[model samples]
Target: MPKQIKLNPLSIYIHIPFCVSKCAYCDFISHRVGDFEINGGVEAYFNSLKTEISLYSGLLEKSKVRSIYIGGGTPSSVDGKFIHNLIMQLKSLANFSDEIEITLEVNPGTLTEEKLNHYIASGINRISMGLQTTNDQLLHKIGRIHSTNDFMTSYEAIKRAGIENLSLDLMFGLPGQTIKDIENAIHLVGILKPKHVSAYSLKIEEGTPLSESYQKGSITLPDEQLERDMYHLLINGLAEKGIMQYELSNFSSASFESKHNLVYWENEAYLGLGVSAHSKLNNERFSNTSRIYDYSKLLSEGKLPIVEKEFIDTSEDLFESIMLGLRLNKGVSINKLNQKYNIDFNVKYANALENLLKQGLVILTEDILKLTIKGMDLSNQVFLQFMED
Candidate 1:
């Protein structure tokens, strides 16, 4: 059983590792269901997950669940009954807030009216659908299993199911994406008017097919200037549609922001379940085994299946808190940092802060320190400045 500790309202993340097909740029721990009966695998996995949840029942019963995020290799690809059962089990084990946000990540290809209905019945109040791009040819190039029509059908079904809280994932910097492609996507999203939007730039992860193609000169990406232009265009476009950019890549209208993701950016504790899942609790971080077979084997023998664990110390904790907190538009509270860490935030990194301020990359007020527009664009460099020796 996991350790029992009192905390503020906790968030839960459930990983689903099954997908219909792997995208060319994907490197996450996911299995493609090709000619295999996914039901059996899903059942077995859920069984293990239940056992894992049971191990934390004591801690859960003592804590109120603030949010639940069901994510992964196309969570919509699996049977909705499995998801319903998982939510039911969690509810049985925990004290869920009446207004708790429960979100499920979905793919356009796997959505159905039946599934959406089941999801609604299961207490999933939010749907995050991946509609990476509106270009059918670009979608095909990325090995996406859905077309624009499929996305439209799924989106309509989500609305018909009475799910008002929706989040759409869009991507730029694709293999052949253009400014027009992004404009078209943003326009479509504007028409749909989802509560939230996550606009990201595609990165060619090493060892993925996309990276291989990039190295072989078969894949060409937008130049740095063009990519920057696309990012700004998306920001301006979404803003014009009344979507507030709350974080670097996430935008929302009023209270429709992603509560579960905010847990991470706020540096709060969360519990992760299933294969390759990660958890941060009690000032420690740990992760489950990545291999499904290994995860199953350990769980079957009544073990926790933890493959990695790190006990965060004070310095590391402070660093992480600042690093993650800076990702948000609200930025980090200087007062909170001083109160918690007992260090002069300005003095510790005076030189770095001076250089960043001179470049108009950051702003430091009496109570808050945050990235400016130029700072967000060069956030990586800003983040590097805060690293402790």
Candidate 2:
């Protein structure tokens, strides 16, 4: 039998794979569903999720959950009752912290006042709404079902539901997006004053509709300089609004940082359930199969649906510790690395560190090592130097 290792203060992620319509830029595991499919598919999916949750009861019993995040193709698109049931089930199965943060991702088109109220009553304390761009033309071009007005309505409903911690997901560098478009979006974010904001640049993911259009020269994104300028604009604008940049793409007011995401960036253990979810526990990293039917069938047959698992070796763990830790503004602790790996970090990567420092990409203090402003932009270049052959 595998040794039972207690994972105290764990984080849980539940993936919901149904969306009313797929966004053009999306590459996540999600499917479009109609009313007929919603009736049967939603129930079947939730049943599989419950069975999967029970499979981890032994591990969960030994752990204390610190955060729970429900993410998806569009979690808010589902019937609110399903979400409520999932939360109630988790509450009954696990030992939750008194101050645990429960976040649910919402899309403007799918949210309703009643649904928001039901979420608030179900112990969900945080709401993350995807409002990629406020420009209706851009929204339609990107296959979003909702307009800026719809986002406003949903935002107001969430506030009226009495949920205080709210996050807005914004994007820049979309096809045909200009600086003015980004400025207008950030201006709206300032007006609403969400507790958190995630401003990400558009990446043309392979197999996505956006990528296909780019391949055919039908979609033209902003150039590299424009994207960088937009990022700087976002940083400066949000800073003036008292939303500090805590991560590369995330900003928040004081004490409003995302605790669930921090679990991943800090290299902490987390449990993931549902189709296409990923998990890291007991020095192992794994992910579930992306296919919903495959995931559900395996659970129905009394099996875990995980399709991939890797036991992280010592060197890989060290590399991940540095790579993930440096993504945060606080950076990594050199002393902790030295202690944990029993190797002098300064000596192990002396050449790489020296080159990075000379390039003004990183700073090494007495204890902590972190990326500089320029380094965060060229982070991939700096991180590549830490890779072990």
Candidate 3:
């Protein structure tokens, strides 16, 4: 008998790049539905997505998919039937693990009970809802379409639908935001008791509406000290709610950590579909075309629609492993890294390790190297130490 090839576990991320309205701070590749609705609507995009999936069917057949994350400019903004059909199509093509986790990212004022029902029936076991802040004034200031009431209604509906795996996304460090606002948001988390919380500090990306306004001096964000204060408050507040810190900006209740996100942080291989999506498979990392027309045109020509690709050489791979692994609280197992890379971790990274240790950034307990709380705060600085200079 011929030797059997070992199959690897995979994760899938499907992007729904349609939004009801764009937020001021967002830099994600998403189009307003009104503009695209006239030009063949989302149906055209879904067709192209199916084509992309078909192109990867052989690869899918060789891997067992463990997680599927349907993210977008509010995936719930569109008709639920489209999402249901898409999930069914993927199921037909891939060998899904029996304990597969399917997550759908939603926005408030867009999700209805009927739409949520469709998602539940389609096997979406997890829902990540965006509730940037509870203040209505802040919602308007940030150009968000939903109010606190809208988020409350949508959140309650998800709970009533019996979908227990819920994750709430919150943002700090917005213009005109105060400590009181963050306190209120944290209090709401305690009251709501969500399974997971992702608290991120705002970064004003260049060319974004918020960034433009900031550049014009029309608005001013909280100072560096205030932002740091807000982050520490988040860490302390979530702990009081029994949501322990697992990653730098993520908190979860017990085993409720996001498996799909873990795949990325663990440097595992996964496939990303749809326009502007990125993927790391085998030894190469690649991304699809960001333009809708270009994506559809290439797919119609029976091509992969990939616009960029790069091979992750062993040196780059090791650095990535070290960088991503440190993002977790448990940190990386040096023994495993040594075995996989065939090197002594201490000897190979002695200089970097010495610097990190002296700076109180990282500590190695036995064979595991993990970041201290201070290191987590200054994670970018720590990652820089591991780079091949």
lDDT of 2: 0.91
| Residue lDDT tens for model 2, 191-310 | 999999999998888999888889999989899999999999999999998999999899999999999999988888999999999999989999999998899999999999999999
Worst 10 residues of 3 by lDDT: 33-42
lDDT of 1: 0.90
List candidate 3 stretches off by more than 4 Å: 1-6
Structural RMSD, model 1 = 2.9
lDDT by residue for model 3 over 1-389, one digit each (tens)? 99986767999999999999999999999999878778676889999998999999899888889999999877887889889988888889888899999999999888887898899889999999999898899889888999999999989999999999999999999899999999999999999999999999999998899999999999899998899899999999999999989998899999999999999988999999999999999889999999999999999999999999999998899999999999999899999899888889899889999999999999888789999989988999999988996
Q: Candidate 1: which pairs clash?
A: none
Which residue pairs in candidate 3 collide?
A: none
**How much does candidate 1 score in TM-score?**
0.96
Per-residue error (Å), model 1, residue 40: 1.5
